[model samples]
Target: MTLERITLAGGCFWCLEAVYEHVRGVHRVESGYSNGAHPSPNYEQVCSGTTGHAEVVRLDFDPAVVSLRELLEVFFTIHDPTTLNRQGADVGTQYRSAIYWHTEAQRALAAEVIREANEHHGGRVVTELQPETNYHPAEAYHQHYYARHPDQGYCAFVVASKVDKFLASFKRLVK
Candidate 1:
């Protein structure tokens, strides 16, 4: 099977990771830092907003199961791409909205989706579309955070809401 991947930063990686884990075509979603100047930057460094890294989820998926456009639709729908460097109260460059495309086809599709989403959101989409590098997976404790801590405050309030939105809107895409 031909697998395609994209990196997305929409607020906290935990939120995106939680929602993506439940999607039908997503094979893997790893939380990482990208588009940063520093190499091997840790969570604290990224959170400081000085590393230039965005907390991102790199997803591996099969196009036969779900098209890139469908994934982009979900990405744009679930998060407030209109916000710059913040989602809800989570503020910082690490929380920026960004799409890191892996291929030209992906890049083109992402731009198209962003334009459409911007139109729908009244032309205020602040989501950045860029070629990302310097990816470093978050510490193991961060992996599957929502699943492991469903009752936790952040997960219950923020992440679960996003997941509910995804599940409600994209019923056919749920696995």
Candidate 2:
């Protein structure tokens, strides 16, 4: 099986991690900070907005099972790509929408997908497309956060909504 890796920053990492973990093609969904200025920024540092990092999820998936286009469609549905540096109550550069590609093909596809997403979003899709860089895995507590702390306030209210959206919108892709 061929595997492709893509990193995405759309609001909170927990929300992305929570949803992608349930996607069929996804082998692993790692919550992290990406394209940041800091070499090894922690959650607090990234949250402070001084680290120049966006909370992101690095996904390992097989394209044969779930194409990039499908994954991106799910992403657009889960978060408000039109918002700049914010999702719900979360604010700062760390919560911005972005797509960090690992390959040239992925880069090109990301551009096309963003354009389509923009049109559907009233021409205001603010998702950034960039090369993956300066990535640092978040602390252990952040991994599988929704599954581990489903009752936590943020997970119950915010993350759960995104997961529910994914389930409702992409039933066939759900794992």
Candidate 3:
């Protein structure tokens, strides 16, 4: 099976990681920092926003099982791409919406998805499209935060809704 990788940032990595972990085609979901100036940034550094890194999740998935277009659709459904540098109460450059594509085809598809999202949202989508760069796995504590701490206030209140949205909107893609 040929697997493809894509990295995405849309608000706190916990939210994205929580939802993608259950996606059918996804083999791995790693929370990380990417497309930043720092060579190796820790969670604190990334959260500070000075590192220019966005909190991202790198997903390894089988294209044959689930197409990238489906994944992008789930992404747009779970987060508000129209907002710049924030998702809900989270605010900062690190929380911005972005797609870090690993291949030319991925780039093209992401662009097309963003265009459709923009039109659907009245040309207000702010999701960034950039080549994958400088990805560093987040601290071990963050690896499966939602699964580990389902009752944690933030996870329960903020992250859970996104995961629910994904499950409700994309039942066919659920693992």
Model 1 CA deviation exceeding 4 Å by range: none
Residue 7 of model 3 has an lDDT of 95
Which regions of candidate 2 are displaced past 4 Å? none
* Alpha carbon lDDT at 99, candidate 3: 99
The TM-score ranking, best first, is 3, 2, 1
* Residue 81 of model 2, lDDT score: 96
What digit string (tens of lDDT, one per residue) describes model 1 on residues 29-97? 999999999999999999998999999999999999988888888988889999999999999999999
Which regions of candidate 3 fall more than 4 Å away from where they truly are?
none
Which ten-residue region of model 1 has the weakest summed lDDT?
68-77
lDDT of each: 0.93, 0.95, 0.95
Residue-wise C-alpha lDDT for candidate 3, range 48-123, written one tens digit per residue? 8899999999999999999999999989999999999999989999999999999999999999999999999999
| Number of backbone clashes in candidate 3 | 0
C-alpha displacement of 124 in model 3, angstroms? 0.1
Q: Give TM-scores for every candidate, taking all chains together and pairing residue i with residue i.
A: 0.98, 0.99, 0.99
The true-structure Cα RMSD of candidate 1 reads 0.7
